[model samples]
Target: MQQGGNPNDIFIKINALLEEAKPRFSEECCIYKVPNNIRKLNEDAYTPQVVSIGPFHHANQNLQKMEDQKRLYCRQFIERSETKNLESLVSCVQEMEEEVRSCYSDDIKLSKEEHVMLILVDSCFILEFLLRFYFLVTRGDDSILLPEQLLVHIRNDLLLVENQVPFFVLDKLYYLSFPSTLNGEDLHNHPPLLSLTCYILPGFMISEDNFVLLSVSSDVDFGRIAHFVDLTRKLLLKSSKLFQLSTSDCSREAQVTHIYSASELNELGVKFEVNKNTECLLDITLSGHTLRIPFIRVHDWTELVLRNLLAFEQCHCIHESYLTDYTLFLDFLINTDKDVDLLIKKGIIENWLGDSNAVAKMFNGLAANTVTPDFNVQYSNIFKDLNAFCAHPWNKKVATLKRDYCNTPWKTVASIAAIFLLILTIIQTIFSILQVVH
Candidate 1:
């Protein structure tokens, strides 16, 4: 007992504990596991299916099948990078281990060697894959992405929360592979890092028409990127000034509350039109009684992608949570299956899901545990305008009449005829009253 309680040993243990308590590295904090509370809503959305790029899901048995494949790609990448010394590459990557570790919110459970191996293997695979895949597409030979379905799954896996490697790691490997000494101009003239990603994935096109989707600034620092998900988000919300939180700066004022569904808005004679403008997916403009919304394709992958995006906003970027706000806006717009059907009919929502009810459930489900901030400038004007329009007694009566009677062509004709007769009767009564006065 006396030996175990020695004063010198106790002081040494105390010092070690204190040393571990402080934050260790100065790297920008990003790339996190979906918070457990948020992930619980839809665990499948956050989990990877085909590949695990980082340590979060490295131990998962399901993705172990791809580990050997990852090594194969790693070998190919080393050869392509023309790396003279594999040991130097390892050392370079290892040098940033503390910085890389600081990027993730979770304490990486992998040992130093294992973590470094993960970064090297994964970063090489992604860089090699993106470059080769882009080259294939530009050359009009998609045999690399052929057998289509597998490519689809891989594309889907890359955007999953658990299937991300930090952008820094990827950048290091990329520059090392294609060194800058002889290729300085290539760095400035190279297509966006997202070009291959966009080309591989649907909904994004690298056309001049959609510069917002493919326009990657050469001057923008790659180190600023958290992961693939962050890049995707940056593309989607191209204008941060609009959705970023502001109180005094917001010109559009609104209360944080739900509005009528798409069906209700339709009955109110508020037309829902597909947005022709390609500014942003969440850019919803309400001009007079018409709500112009960009069409969003809903497929098997849509739910997972949207949920993870929302989760990322919740965990890291709560103040600038445009995706969450957009989902909440949609939740209000789509309260029921009837609302979903209304949007589908109007081309505002391209629902590829098997059941319309599932789309309804998803939109409604997205708002779970969300507390909408009142002064969301991007949508506040739209919300306020809609509410003011809906609040008028005349609009409510017209909507009620349309839902109750003016549903069919025959009913609409009958309503017009009845109104005409009522007007004619009033005119006739006025003429009789004038005759009596004369």
Candidate 2:
């Protein structure tokens, strides 16, 4: 019996362990912990700074200071909600606890009561925050977002892949909070949550001219959206006919072998121009010798937003990583500050960070830990065409000649003078030969 180790006891222990080891992932799972390989490059970009929304960062002591704020928002949300009582909201979340748990990639360790409470408070906070933001923008009302720095931090935190609740949770809470809006009386005053979300994240719009705030319709299915990150991705790709049409044909096994930098392309007679035809930043196009790219603003929080989006695509999107592909394309075109400067001068990039080197570094660092599966279809044709154009003997010779003799006005004049002198000397020699023959 060796230390009273019984067969039945061992069997029971093994059975319990097996139960715990069952798969936690579901088809609904979208919210993910940013992979360490990606997060290690810049932890602050992926980690929530002032607030934690979901289960992944719920236990972080650094984020606990925001707990009071969360409760306060939740209270305000309830006070203004149509239900006007806490119990209804609590019940709604409690009913969806299992489904909500399935939405997260990691197994939530909180007990049912704790999990429900977490979801309730976080969801209400987000809903209320968006509502206030909407009123502030549309009616000039003051809001907690009045503090510019805090607003920036909150925007960054809310967009982080790790710091998100399911969008459906927010949607359900939103409708429940404003039941009368469904009947159309207060519909104008209370826009859908998605529209308010767009207002708060204006940077993702790329161009205001083409960014349409989502309206609730049969075409707009809120159920499919996993979280704010997914919504942002959708918003980005919504207007890109190129992406919409080509995504299905894109091959995941292909890779982009090579492409020249912006300066290199310029040297090869390739012109870069600001694309005015489309608002989607991903709708980059190449025609003849010109490359047209939509304008993108780079600011303090740009990297933070992009890194999170990149991480989300890496973790979830299997077939179409549009954002990832776009990022890799930019990385291929920008290798140094010179490339950034070239793009800035061409109006492709609005560098608000004010440092070209920093912008270059940001683009270069974006694709460090990510994989571009559909790179071949996404921009492989452009690379192929550019390489073919650049490789032509005539093109290279012309480029070389320009570099050697015509790069400056003084050099151009000197070369022209030398050529004229050579022609004159050749004519003189021919005349001298004729004289000798005579």
TM-score of 1: 0.84
TM-score each candidate.
0.84, 0.90
Model 2 alpha-carbon miss at residue 91, Å: 0.8
lDDT by residue for model 2 (1-438), tens: 557789899999999998888676688789988888888999889888899998999999998888998888889889888779788888999999999999888878899999999999999999888888778643233335767787778878899999999988998888888988756668677876767776656464534434443343224568888888887777676667576633575455566667889988888788999998878888788998899998898988889988888888888984578788888889989999999999999989999998999999999999897876556375777777888889999889888888899888999999999999999999999999999999
Question: Superposing all C-alpha atoms, what RMSD in Å does each candidate have to the true structure?
Answer: 4.5, 3.2
Which pairs clash inside model 2?
none
Give the best candidate by TM-score.
2
Q: What residue runs in model 2 are displaced by over 4 Å at the alpha carbon? A: 1-19, 137-143, 202-204, 213-218, 245-253, 376-378, 407-409, 423-438
Model 1, residue 277: what's the lDDT? 71
lDDT score, candidate 1: 0.73
> Local distance difference test, per candidate?
0.73, 0.82
Candidate 2 local Cα displacement, residue 231, angstroms:
0.3
Give the Cα error of residue 111 in candidate 2, in Å: 1.0
Off by over 4 Å in 1: 1-27, 137-146, 180-182, 185-194, 200-219, 239-255, 371-375, 424-438
